[model samples]
Target: MSSLRSSELDGDSDDSQLAAKFWEVKLPDVVPLDDLKAIEKTQAAEVIQRAWFSHMDKIIFQLLKHTICAAENCVTHEILKKVCPSEAALVKDPSVQCKVRFRFGGKNFPPFIVFKIFLHTGGHGNKYFSGKNTLRPSSEAVVDACKLMGNRKYYDQIIQDQLQFQKYKVADEVDVVTMKDYMHFTSFLDETPAYLGGKSNCWRRLSLENFPKTMIMYDIMDYATSGTLSDRLQKELKYLLQKPKSKEMHHDQLRIVSQVRHWG
Candidate 1:
């Protein structure tokens, strides 16, 4: 019995349970709203635009596709490094910009994470370059990339226009927006009636005299980004755990299965 117990612990330690709990506590670290405007201010427009260009599609696809690939590069890479270091290392290289290849509909999407044209070589001949994760491009690089990419570019135009009306939107849409309503609209992926005009108590006008629009979007994006990742990882890990562990149902299997059959 002692030898058997030891063998069981060695075979299936169930590391994922700890991982799931770890995820709950780990998500909020990256959602610093106060820092977003600072990020925008410090980052160049071009680099931001390029980061969006390279990684936005992947982000959207992952969200809409699996709905759980929510971890931003910084978080995802760290977690992945713990779970699968070899895979994480591929994209962590400063020189190697990473793009998530989506294999769906019998098609393939290649890696696209690149923001600048230049590359850096580390001391040990490792190629170190910035913009490996374009979505989170360094602020200065964003500005530089945007200038190089051009002013009338679609992304720049859209962001510029959006920032102009941010003050109005915050006053009319965000600041007064209640927590419940915000959760409903965002968590449900509400898009039909439109959040601002939607017919729900969750949508109400609150005084934004003290609210800053820049601060609001910054906070909103951080939540959206990190929450998405936490939700995704949990869902996938749960699905994996519930899968049957064996093909046969022997007498011993039945006894083992019945002993602690709470999981799946």
Candidate 2:
């Protein structure tokens, strides 16, 4: 009888905890700008400045959240569940499906993009945003920083993986046999979020012997969006697809490849 009573109590406790976890909990929100330090109402561009700073804070929080998640052992889906389990309901909603299709251009984009963006921007330090020579800075410096904030390590890894994938293609000589590993490589990206450290070393082993054209296309498409060798790839694919392609395309491909090589 004691054991039965203990089991009933444990069941009730579990149900209570689950209920608590399902609801929203509030915490105190901090204000970075104190009353005295706040922007003056008469100051030039005061409202615009406030709005801009507010947006910056939002971006910073977003970057911080992704960074913390990336450093965690949990999978991307698990992270989503912890953050907002209520979103689970959307899985069965037709409107949610329609939105997903629209957002990904009629197809789903693998979650890797989100992972990549988070990892890229979560990088520590101000290397991406140093002012140009101090006085009278150029807009280019700021833009370059913003671009770097999302285009460094993620780009490099994708490019290296693509090169390895292409090497297998060239070695096999036959389009069919040379690209077998392509599916596994691209599927890895499509299956797991990049921030989860899902791009494993095994990805390098993908070769023409294991994959097909559909898989090759998937790999190419993902690499193309990675912005690593995108410009060179865009030009190369265009040239190879074009009949009597332009010399400019050839030159640009060479230029882009050379630039990346130098960067390495």
Candidate 3:
């Protein structure tokens, strides 16, 4: 039996050696450093180009939003004619002054035209209107104007873009609300007295003038009673109470607890 066990151990060792050799032969080929770097560079360039295109799209939308009359008669026909002659010719009615809606992007624009217009028309720094050059049209704006005049179907596209812009604006407002505004709302909810056993009208009656004092008092009470406070609230309280040098510093170090004593 011992001889059989020794033979089994030798067979196990041989199997392990074969497995190691198999892995050594089947290893994946290593990519060259130069090729890897080239791939990374191509990917980074694509990302940069996409970001640039998105930014330019936003700028074009803003320009169109401001310039377009949104009425039936093409009021800005003269400006459109100068910016995009080909597109201006396609306007529904050139005789009457009314609104013109423009579409932008894809094969409609000439190479480097957007950049040229952006530079000359002061589309940089988000200041489309600088000094006396307020109404100057950029190449992108021209291309967009052309698209609008050439295709009557693009009104829906422009409306969608406006909605997208408004969506982003609302998202930004929500982000702002989550910060200081949210804190104020929470404090108001906590302190305001209930009317008819409902807290709905508390917000309407909240006094902005007394907000600071109320917050300070609540912070002191919370700390003294060992009540849990969120990190943001604690930080705000610390600021309101002043630093370690202030006379209110001792309030943070004190805690009160109730205990019952029984007499036999």
* Clashes within 3 Å, all models in order: 19, 8, 6
Q: Residue-wise lDDT of candidate 2 within 79-195, one digit each (tens)?
A: 334334454344334444311110112233222222211212234422211131121325666456557656775466446546644654421112333345545534443343334
Say what the RMSD of model 1 is.
33.2
lDDT of 3 by residue, 1-264 (tens): 999999999999999999988888666789999999999999999999999977655533332322221211223234344455664565534453323433222354211111011112233332222211221346566466557666554455346435533654321123345566555543433332332111222212111121122222222323323444535445444333333464344333221001111212
The lDDT for every candidate, in the order shown, is: 0.38, 0.38, 0.38
Off by over 4 Å in 2: 1-87, 96-147, 150-186, 195-264
Candidate 2, overall lDDT? Answer: 0.38
Clashing pairs in 2: 177-208, 178-208, 179-208, 179-211, 180-210, 180-211, 181-210, 181-211
Candidate 3 versus the native: TM-score?
0.24
Candidate 3 Cα misplacement greater than 4 A, ranges: 1-3, 14-27, 67-264
Give per-model TM-scores. Answer: 0.16, 0.17, 0.24
| Model 1 C-alpha lDDT per residue in residues 1-264, reported as the tens digit of each score | 999998888656666667677787644567477788777766777788888866755543432322112223113353345444675687677667554332223133422121111223444443212232232345876688678868777365446436534643432223336776545534222221332222221211212121122222112233333433333334443332233455432322222212221232
